[model samples]
Target: MKRLAALGWPALGVVTLVLLWVGAALYMGKPHVLPGPWAVAETMFSMRGPLVVAAAKSLSRVGVGWLAAAAVALPAGWAMGAVPALDRELRALLSLLRPIPPFVWLPLLLLWVGIGEPSSWMVCFVAALFPILAHARQGVAETPVALAAAAENLGATGLHLWARVRVPAALPLTFTGLKAGWSLAWMSVVAAELVGADGGLGQLILDSRNLARPDLAMSGMAVLGAVAAVTGGLLGWAERRVAE
Candidate 1:
């Protein structure tokens, strides 16, 4: 019953949104400018094949970038968090970089890596890196000193102390960072693809615009939103399990 209520609320919200969208489209009386929900849905179904291929490509880029970011950021963040000296040295640099949007790197990446898969992956990596790194540092910094002392007294030192005491304590916050990083990575990959790409949902949207097909463009956006929502829901469920 509780689960039904949880699902019902969001379903209601989506229905309400669709109605509003349809109404707005009717008021405009121009399908080209703002296609109604039905038109978008039709376009989505019609382009399923191309959409699937594009979505797969985008997901692949996100997956590769996210994993790479996790590998580099987690260790670097842990090291910085564990050592005050290292944290102090890097804090200012990180602060400067954090505010810069991932999309801003597009032109530079294009220049450096050329207009290809590598550039897209690089942008996604940058997007995912900061949040993960920040959270990891915070998680480690917030670990109880008493816990570390206890482990040390028990002959836990160096890597063993970090592995058994620090990391376990910080897992929850680390997971939070991972979730945030993934969201950023997803967004970044889409933007990267939109700007310059041979294939992906973003590229599909761009192509739709060029072809004067607003319905198709909206369909691509809907697909992107749906995919992000599903992935986020799964991540949230996993996060809850980890917390429990």
Candidate 2:
């Protein structure tokens, strides 16, 4: 009951949004220009097959890229935090690279590798990498000095100490980075797909515009929004579990 009550405000907001949308769509009476919610819903249902396939492809790309980023970032970030010399060495380089958008690499990557999964994966990897890496380093570096001293006094050493003390202490911030990376991965995948994807939600939206089907484009947007909602819910649940 409390959970349902907690969700009530958000549900009301959605309802309000839909109501306003219906009103605007009705007043405009231009289905081709700005489709009503029902029209987009109909398009979503009618184009379910293609939508599913596109969503799946994009999701797979995100999964691969995010996982790859986590694999590299977790270890590298830990090392940077563990070793002051390493952090000093990489800090300047990281600052230089982080500001360059993932899409900047797309053209060069496309020219080199051709448009496909490789390009998409690379874009997603680049997008997801920085935050996870930065946050992980911060998390470990910020672990209490007293905690480390205590652990040392208890005869904890090396990787075992890291595993028991630093990892747990770092998890909250690390998870924050993971969630941020995951979100960025989705955004990057869409951008990557818009240019080179044979099939993806981004391509679907682009095609809808070219075909003059606003409803279809809106349907694609709705699907992406649904994905965001689902991702947020799952990430939130996982965060709570770790916190517990």
Candidate 3:
């Protein structure tokens, strides 16, 4: 009974949204521009295989790029946080690069890496790196001085101090960065896929537009939204587990 009660509002909200969507579609009277839910559902069902394949490809690219971003960000952030001189030295360069939008690098990357997986990954890497580094730097910088002093007194030095004291202290903020980086990476991958890829959710949307299929385009958009939502939720759950 309690479980059913807990589920009720969400179910009700879903139904309400469906009704509202149907009402708008019917009232709008332009199937070509704004297909009804049923039309979109049909598009989704009929093209499930292609959608799944495209989603998988996009997810793979995003995963690799995101991991690479974390690899670079964590170590660099740790170094910058632990050493004030290094942080100051990198500050000017970071400032210049950070303000430059991720997409702005696309042209340069396209020229260097060409239109391929490398270029796509580069876009994702750039998009994911800054947030993680920013959050990580903040996390490490905010570690309590007293805690560090205690660790030093206890004979923790050099790498041990960073490993035991800094990393753990920074975990929460670092987690925040990871979550943000994941989202940014996902969006960046889709954008990159759309711009030049042969196949992906982005490419599917591009194809739909080329074929004048608004229903298909909308379906792709919906799938992208769903993927991002699920991924974000899973990451948040993992963060909570880590925190505990």
Computed on alpha carbons, the lDDT of every model, listed in order, comes to 0.91, 0.91, 0.89
Best by TM-score: 2
Residue by residue across 23-100, what tens digits does model 3's lDDT show?
A: 998999999988999999999999999998988888888888889999999888878887899999998999989988
Candidate 3 similarity to native, TM-score: 0.92
In Å, residue 14's CA in model 2 sits off its true spot by 0.9
Tell me the tens digit of each residue's lDDT in model 1 across 89-143.
9999999999999999999999999998999999989999999999999999999
Off by over 4 Å in 3: 1-17
For candidate 2, the lDDT comes to: 0.91
lDDT of 2 by residue, 118-149 (tens): 99998989998999999999999999999999
Answer with 2 or 3, whichever has the higher lDDT: 2
TM-score of each model, in listed order:
0.94, 0.96, 0.92
Decide which is better by TM-score, 2 or 3.
Answer: 2
Clashes of 2: 0
